[model samples]
Target: MRTEFDFAPLYRSSIGFDRVFNLLNNAQRLHAIDNWPPYDIVKTGEDDYRITMAVAGFAEGELDVTQERNVLVVKGGRADKQEGEYLHRGIGSQSFERRFELADHVKVETAKLANGLLSIALRREIPEAMKPRQIAISSGLSDQTAPLQIEAEKQVA
Candidate 1:
């Protein structure tokens, strides 16, 4: 079965979400799906995530993890070997390309392979300026003067 995606409606909506519309319009990126070596994305902690991919026959040297422009790419390819006679060959060795979408500010922490599973951890740190802050209220009017209007001064400044 084949599936087609239409991004015309998204562009016509004009809901001020240009980022989403632009992403949808980029067909080259939209069609890139990782089907080889099934994987899972799990949220382990606050702002923490882990991506586990099943690479049964792939070795550490054959796999590579890299981040390019907010995209996590994992590629695996076995080294070429001379054809040898095998009476019973059950293990399958194939090359694959996997891509993952990462949000702004999200970065790859580390990657490790163990027990045929390749685990990649990611973390995002919220900027201090973007975090919420509590406002302090004055208990009473000061002896010199009451609360002065700072908006006018801010505007002039």
Candidate 2:
């Protein structure tokens, strides 16, 4: 049994949080459950991250990694060309697609496949104008300053 949530009230009051609401809505609408090609996400540094997916039977050219805006997609599959019939098949290389949601300013650094594990590096590079900075305050002129007088010579008409 699945229950649908009403986010209209939340959207009416929130500001600048459309992404968060969309993520929540998408999570609720998942019809099929997929557990194949397991993956792990780890935080390596303060602004660095890594995603590792186990793709045992897939070759180097069978996988693809793409980043569109704030979404990271990884797909793996290959055509089957086996000669003999398999009695007991355990290693499955069926087509599988996985998606990951990334935060703003996060970008893909590198992707490498080694030992049946596909590792994707991600780094969050915030722009200089968006970073926080301290402002210096100084004391200068005041409103209580007196006016200056100018000396003038007497002239006959």
| Predicted structure with the largest TM-score when compared to the true one | 2
Q: What is the RMSD of candidate 2?
A: 4.9
For model 2, how does the per-residue alpha-carbon lDDT over 1-157 read when each residue is reduced to its tens digit? 7889999999999999988999999989866579788889999999999999999989989999999999999998799989799999898879999999899999999999999999999999999999999997756564556788787997989
Query: Could you tell me the lDDT of residue 94 within candidate 1?
Result: 75
Please list the residue runs of candidate 1 whose C-alpha ends up more than 4 Å from where it truly belongs after superposition.
1-16, 24-34, 82-90, 138-157
Model 2 local distance difference test score? 0.92
TM-score for all predictions?
Answer: 0.70, 0.84
Model 1 whole-model lDDT (C-alpha atoms): 0.83
Query: Which candidate number would show the highest lDDT if scored against the true structure?
Result: 2
* Candidate 2 residue runs with Cα over 4 Å from true position: 1-3, 140-157
Compared with the true structure, all predictions reach lDDT values of: 0.83, 0.92
State, as a TM-score between 0 and 1, how close model 2 is to the true structure: 0.84
lDDT of 1 by residue, 1-157 (tens): 5455776777687787876666655644454354678889999999999999999878899999999987899999997575898798766567888877787789999999999999999998778898899998776555467666666544544
